[model samples]
Target: MAVLSLKKSNLPSVWLFSFQVIFLALFVGLKFQTGYDWPIYEAHYAAIQRGESFYLDFEFGYEWIVQVASRVGLAFEQFSAVVSVLEVAFIAIAVRHFFPRYCLVVMAVMYSVPDFYLIPTFSLLRQGLAVSIFLIGVCKVFSGKKISGLVYFTIACSLHYSVIGGVFLLGLVYIFPLSRMTFSLIFAAAVVLYVASFDIIRGVVEVLIVYVDPKYMIYLDRDVFNASFAYRAAFAVVSLVIFTCIYSAWMRRESSDGDHFDRGFGLLSYRLALLGVLIPLIIFGFPTLSTRYQYFFAIFVIGCSLGALQYVNYASRIMVVAVIAVTAYLPFYRFLSSPLSIVYIPYQSQLFYDQTNSTGHDRTNDLLNQLDVLWSK
Candidate 1:
C-alpha cells in the first residue's frame, strides 16, 4: 500500500476530490424519481411496507434486504441512494490503491456514461449494486487479489444470478494467455459461433437454455428486436476504437517501464471491448434478451473504456476530459431523442420540487438550504 504524503497530494487529487463531491451529490440525490422501473420499485416498496410477501420472483438476498429496510420505514429514495453510495464507494476503494491516476476517471465514467448510469443506477437497482460489486471484484482480480475478487463475485452472484454466466466467460477470458494470437482466436471463434446459420444457432440456444434460469427462458423468442441492433453494433465499434487506442498506449508504456506497469487491466479492457461487440450480436434478435443482457455490457463498455482512459493521452493529459465527453454523448443523445427517453429524462430532485410546482423560487437556493440536511441524513 502507498503512504499518503502532502507532497504527493497535488492538484490532480484536489480536482478529483472536488469532482467526487459533486458527482456523488448528483448521483445520490434522487427524490422520488418517476421513470423507468420506478413504478415497479415503488410498488415493491409499498408491498414490503404493507407486510406483503413480494419479490419472491427475484433474488432472495436482495428481496430480504429491501424488505427489512422497508419494514424499518426508510424513504425509498434515500435507501436507493444508499445503494448508489455503496456502488461508488466500492469502486473508489478498489481504484484508490491500484489505479490512482485513473480512479477519478473511472468513477466519473462509471457514473456519467449515459447508458451505464441510465441502465444501472436509474433502472436495474439490485443489479446495479451487484455490478458495482462485480467491478470492484474485477479490479481486485486484475490486481492479483483473487481471493478478494472471489468474495465480491460471490456476493454479486447471490444478488443476481442472471449475470453469473457472463462472469464465467470473463474468467475464462482472463485465465487464457494474454497474447495477441490467443485473443484473436477467441474473438474470431466467438464471432463465428454467434453469426453461424440459424439451425446451428438454435442448437446452441437450446444448450444455453438448460443452464439459464427458467424464469428468463420466456424471453427466448427471436423476433422481439430490430434496428436497435445496429445502434448497439455501432456503439461496440466506438468502444473498440477507444479501447484499442488506450491499449496501444499501455503497451508502449509497459515496454518502456517493464514490470512496473500493470498491463493486465489493459488486456481486460480490450477483451471487454470485444465482448461489447459480441453481446449485441448474440442478443440482437430478441428485445427481451437484449435488455436482459444490457446491464452487463453497459458496465463492460463503460468500465473498460474508463480504465483505458488512464493510458490514453489525447491532447496530452486532457484525455480524461475527452473521454468523459465521448462517454456521455451517446447516452445523452438517447436520453433526449429515444422513444425510451422517459426512462432517464426529466431529472428529479427535491431541490426542484418547489419550482416544478410553480412556487417561483430558486432551485439552487433550495438545494443549498437542504445541503446540510442532505449531508446530515
Candidate 2:
C-alpha cells in the first residue's frame, strides 16, 4: 500500500530528486575516462598548446570555450570538473521544474548509466556544449516555449550539426499536436518500411551519405553499419513497435506540470526513434556521429526509464536496483588504487593524432599532466 501510494504521487518530490542527481555526478566523475571522444579532446587541447591561432585552426565556438578557460588561468582538469558540475546542475534544475519529486531519481539514474557518462565527455567542447544546450532546449520545449526551443536548437546546430537529431523533434512539436492513434499509425508505418523495403530508406541514406556535409558523418562508415545491418534492422523494428505502444500511452497519461502533454509526446517519439536507430548502429559497431548521437539518445533513455519506474512492479524494481548497485561499484573498484583513472584513456592502443608526430597530442598531455601534478602538489 505504501509503495503504491508513493508510485501514485505525480508531482516531483525534491528530496528524491536531489539525492539522485548528486549520486549521478559522483558516479560519472569517477568513471570520467570512459568516453571515446576523450582522445579527440586531447588532440584539440594539443592544438591550443601549440601557438596555433584557435579560431583560425578550429571552429570559433569551441575555440572560444578553450580560449576563455585558458585566459581565466583554469587548468584542463579544473575546466573538465566545472563542465561536469554545470551539466549536472543544468539538467537537475530542468528536471526539478518538471518533475520535482522524482528529479533526483532521474539525475541519479542519468549519471549511474554508462551511456550518460560517455556522451558529454566526448569531445568536451562543441559536441558536449551542444548536448548540454540540447537538454536545456528540451526543458524549454516541454514548457511549451516553441520559439525558445528553436533558438536553443539553432545554437546547438551551430556548434554541431549532428545535434540536429533534436531538430526533427522540435519541428514535429511545432507542427503536430499529440494524438495516440496517429502516433501509433506512424510508428507502424516506420516498422513496415523498415522491414519490407529498407532499400528505399537505404537509398535516401545513400544520398545523404554522398551529398550531406562531411562533419555530420564525423565517424560514420557504411561498411561498419552494414556488417550488423540485419540484426540491427530487426531490433529497430521490434523496439519501434514496443516503444511506440508504451510511450504513446505514457505521454497521454503523464500529468507533470511545466511539461506540455503534446510536447512530451513528441519528445518521447523522438527518443523512440533514436532507440530504433541505435539498435542497428550499435550492432554494426558504428556510433553514428561519434558520441553526439548516443549521448543525446541516452538522455531520453534515462528520462524515460525514471518516468517508467514510477509504475514499475516489485520484481522489475528490484532488478533495476540491482543494476544500479553493480554499476555504482564498478568505478570504486576500478579506481580505488588508481586515482589516476580519472584521466585514464579508454583506448590506449590506437593513439589519436599520434603522440610522437603530433605536437597537439604532446601539449594536450602536458596540460593534462600539469593538472594532475598541480592537484597532487
Could you say which candidate leads in lDDT?
1
lDDT of 1 at 361: 27
Best candidate according to TM-score = 1
* TM, every model: 0.71, 0.63
Model 1 agreement with the true structure over 123-220: per-residue lDDT tens digits: 67777788768878877787789999899888887778865875876776667635645545654554444444222444566679778775655545
Worst 10 residues of 2 by lDDT: 346-355
Task: Flag clash pairs in model 1.
Answer: none
What do the candidate models score in CA lDDT, each in turn?
0.57, 0.52
Question: Which residue pairs come into collision in candidate 2?
Answer: 12-100, 12-101, 13-100, 13-101, 13-102, 17-104, 20-108, 46-360
What is the TM-score (0 to 1) of candidate 1? 0.71
Each prediction's RMSD to truth: 9.3, 9.3
- Candidate 1 least-lDDT 10 residues: 1-10
lDDT of 2 by residue, 148-206 (tens): 97788777776666667756744554465544456556556655654443434344555
